[model samples]
Target: MPTTAVDPYLDGNFAPVRKEITTDNLQVVGQLPPDLAGMFVRNGPNPQWPPIGKYHWFDGDGMLHGVQISDGKASYRNRYVQTRGWKIEHEAGKAIWSGFLEAPQMDNPHGAYKNTGNTALIWHAGQILALNEGGVPHAIKLPELGTIGEYTYNGKLVSAFTAHPKVDPVTGEMMFFGYSFMPPYLQYSIVSAAGELLQTVPIDIPQPVMMHDFAITENYTIFMDLPLTLSAERAHRGEPLLMFESDRPSRFGIVPRLGNNNNIRWFESSPCYVFHTLNAYEAGDEVVLIASRMSSTSVLVSEDNQLDPDANIPRLHQWRFNLKTGTVREQQLDDVAAEFPRVNENFLGQKTRYGYVGKLANNPLPLFDGVIKYDLSSGTSQTHQFGEGRYGGEAVFAPRPGATNEDDGWLITFVYDEGSGTSELVVVNAQDITSEPVARVIIPQRVPYGFHGTWVSEEQLTINY
Candidate 1:
């Protein structure tokens, strides 16, 4: 890592790497699974130049890192998302827009502000979108991973797109909603499996909240209207414009699959914040929502906010909303702190027993030292630690081509070995996570730590444009 001034996110494994390379026939350890064929792409913050002011991990430029596997051979490549903001900065040869922690400048020929597109990357409508909740998505060309330009659902996307969108495995319909800092605070949209924007509806909300992610079931789409919010008046007072409010109550708005905004039923719960959900499903007349919840989001007050560094952090929390009696039940599922929850796509929006999440370290920084596999049936879990001085990104499960069992797959992730200052693509057997990895494809450079990712199967690759 390069020596620099104090920057929380720019140091350690979170440091930025400025090079992009492509190489085939990567070196591998152990035997690679023959059934695992496709690409695993992850997005993270990688700034081209030093930030002008305070930097938030989410404000850095977007970069896509991928490893392709065919038969037993693996290949690797990475590139910037080529967003409008990044291109402008690249041309100027220096930093322009201020980071998430501050306001942006008024002089910009590029229409959009810093849509760095640095967040979750997912496959939808036969296209891959590099996303950031602050703005719309940038579509990246498939296979080669080149930026094609901004995707607007064919100009139907009137507002920003969410970094997290739920794709139904049954209908092949992708359900997404976007929240903004201004009027029409929230809106929901649906995209067809064939890459067409079918419908969009304006949603009514009392105020703008940080809706990072949401959940979907067989019939309902759940949206979180938590307390943390952004305000222009508060910014002038020197307080963080976007912050968590202690007096506000958390609300969950449950709406029908194809219903309009007026049909929403808002259910209140204890004030909390959720960055990601494990999964959601339907059981009788109740909707089950499982996510990683934080009791108070005060830690987001500032980039250096560590209100309770020694205290227990966010954990697996469960909530059951009944459609019959208008009542809500909530409880803690586990004591272990975890985030970036993922479930097998084979069982998305349906009842299943397993879930995968990254286990947080003891340090004040948000780093995952291990991955935990949760068995919802027995209330038990198995963890795979990357040993000391090693950290990993989210664990995404890749299903076997024609497997019957839900857990019959492999858990894929990028592990950064801080000691060696290098990274590797590790594949762990989903059925037995505690055992050694099935294979480890060595990546020549370090993969900076970031947020959520997805697994794109080879069959999906053939259908994309």
Candidate 2:
């Protein structure tokens, strides 16, 4: 008899928690900030049943873990996004669909693939949306964290939505784009401050690629056309459906706000991959983009379908696309490997001095041992270590009410202590990242390591639904 191999992603903190419980007055290790009020919610994969095939980290049902704080008291709750697929699987009592790593199951009763809304979360248009790039967004109610239903902007959103949408702080408009495996490979859309879907424009691309995230500036939106491309023909030829051609050049498409494909300008760079961007801004004659860059990645599938034994690590990098000269200048900003970069939302489309990112560990699986705060203007950074045997996910910035300075806020994230087998929400002062946490709200249950999160202030929740 042969032993089954253990999937690293399905073990340890990456594993899912089954119980859905709500507890108030969570014990605190330190004093909570008086002004810090609202909820910190993060979305990630949590499979409801045993997977039908080989399981990947990205293949799981969407579950949200939220910690709400108000008046120096905190509460914790978690719930599944309850997408159509989740409901169907619940009725079936088993896994009906496979994951992205496997070929599409054309004859599945429910559908070819499941739209597991297990990637990221966004709060816009007076509702919280749990987003999976391959499907439409699902609205989730706050305080209770219950799924309302699929949100289509009154049937205005007819295409898949990006997990990452840029909400312009000054203009109060949300800018996002969607990519597809078919013709009209990409589409860009915008929503007014009041939550109405304004317009959707088709952008031309050579092939269908897995574009996980993009960047936005004050005057323009930048889309990455990397070489990680998808091809049905390749699948028919018994090769990987997605392949990274290192010989090809990575292209950046810069388009003016509400501009069409005709007005888009393409800038080329060496072959690379960027999963997340810190920020982008317009400076003089150039559009500046700051993100974590890698020479190549085995995120989806490698060039030949087999996983690359030596995966590339991403590092802090910068790219300046010169609009006037039609040229690009790129450089590595730091030597340390990091990802899940974030900045103050208020300064998202403007020049920012400080940014936060998770420091990657050398383990074979994905893990963040600490958070690094970078001062871009001074070319310096500070790290907030999670201590020995402690790991954390992406740290989100919680801006103080009426904060005048960019870094005048707190960085909040769920930190899991491996030694104790417990989890706590650690709040560090954004202005002083090297200092100890201002507060630590101990969670009643274990929080598995997950993807992106956001900080919704108490004022934002006051709006009537």
Candidate 3:
């Protein structure tokens, strides 16, 4: 029998798209200007749209706080003002850059959201500050520009090991998590709105562990273990590392709210698999999580995903879990490599729904990629085909707060169209998950592939407007 090879970037290999051009880009502020010339200017083939309300921004720093996004025709106000950072000056003008390539300073330059519920929640070198309702920054550190508090961390370089402070729903205090060692154990902290240290909580998870997504609900903080382990050098230098190991199964675990630090509830497939994305959404009394699991021998790091011609092919699966009761349901997709699964509640029914992207087995051809709309109750699904030359980013559900049914909400996503040489932001009505888009705004420029983004309402930002 002959095996067909698969290419991970099959859809990414498009004709080319027109990019957003900017005349007033930032100047190289470090020692070696030439090498840093285009660090922030280069974009990827796709960008993610995180599931968030209208009060956050994916700031330039790694922090997800008061960042704003809209179609090209809109310009809004925000509380926190974000900019790139600087490294220590070295002799001979050879600036010491941190992380990958040892480039001077870190340049995330873009994030999804900045929560305004608490200000000091985003205090860190590579993090963006959360904003207030009046569009005023509360934690960012610019003396003349919204500098309202000070935050202190144990690590010399903070962004390398920490997530931006997350506000505690019950206490209004900010929370932060840090990891160390090989597989990477966990450390936790609770901070005040003025950036004062409240308390530090530590945990014994494992080393070399990388957390892609986590969630905080009414009862607990959920963290999932991933194979993407970073070397101590990579962790310290802030370099990005890829995981391709086959010895372990990616596990999903949860931490009770300061209840049991040493206890972790993990779930995985026996045949072995990797969970690519983690998402949580709360409905009545239950918290729902959706993840995409892959079973390839190893993750294809380089773009050329040519499998060894004789290697056996693995399947991808999607799983849903009820965090409170510890119940789970797993569903196997027909022969396709499922990558990203995004879940959100649109209808007020007893079940939930999700949006995922993968190839169709019926085609068996390389180019037909599409999105699936799945219902948790009926156990039925619908495929929204994007055909060829199109790629899908993360899907986000934007529902008016307190809305019971998903029918009144909206589903927003990014679709890269190679033929047009552009990535478009598409908004589809949530009621009819498969309906035509209500609004389609072509991003002025082509944004490369990115991790995630957030949507904030105009009223929550502290805009200078």
Provide the RMSD of all predictions against the true structure, rounded to 1 decimal: 2.2, 1.4, 12.4
lDDT of 3 by residue, 1-465 (tens): 998543232224322222223222212111121111101111112112211111112212222211123222321111222312211111213222222222223352322112122212332223334432112233443212243342333332232224333454345555556655432266655556544565556666665565534555555565666565645465366543443444666666666656446665666543334433334546654455544554433332322243443122333454555656666566665454444454442221123454534433332222325556665455566666553677655455555445656435555555667787765555555566565665554554544333333333322333321
Estimated TM-score per prediction? 0.96, 0.98, 0.56
lDDT head-to-head 1 vs 3, winner: 1
lDDT of each: 0.87, 0.91, 0.41
Identify the candidate with maximal lDDT: 2
State the TM-score for model 3: 0.56
lDDT of 1 by residue, 208-242 (tens): 88888998888889999988887867877877878
In the range 1-465, model 2's lDDT, one tens digit per residue, is 999887777888888899999999999998999999999999999999988877888999999999999999999999998999999999999988988778889898888978888889888867888899998999888878899999899999967899999999999899988999898999999999999999999999999988989998999999999988989999999888877778889999999988989999999999888899999999999999999998887777623343443346889999999999999999999989899999999999899999999999877677999999999999999999999999999999999999999999999999999999999999999988998899999999999999989888897777615
Number of the top candidate by TM-score? 2
In model 1, which regions exceed 4 Å deviation? 1-4, 106-112, 303-312
Candidate with better TM-score, 2 vs 3? 2
Model 2 CA deviation exceeding 4 Å by range: 302-310
Q: How far is 13's C-alpha from truth in model 2 (Å)?
A: 1.0
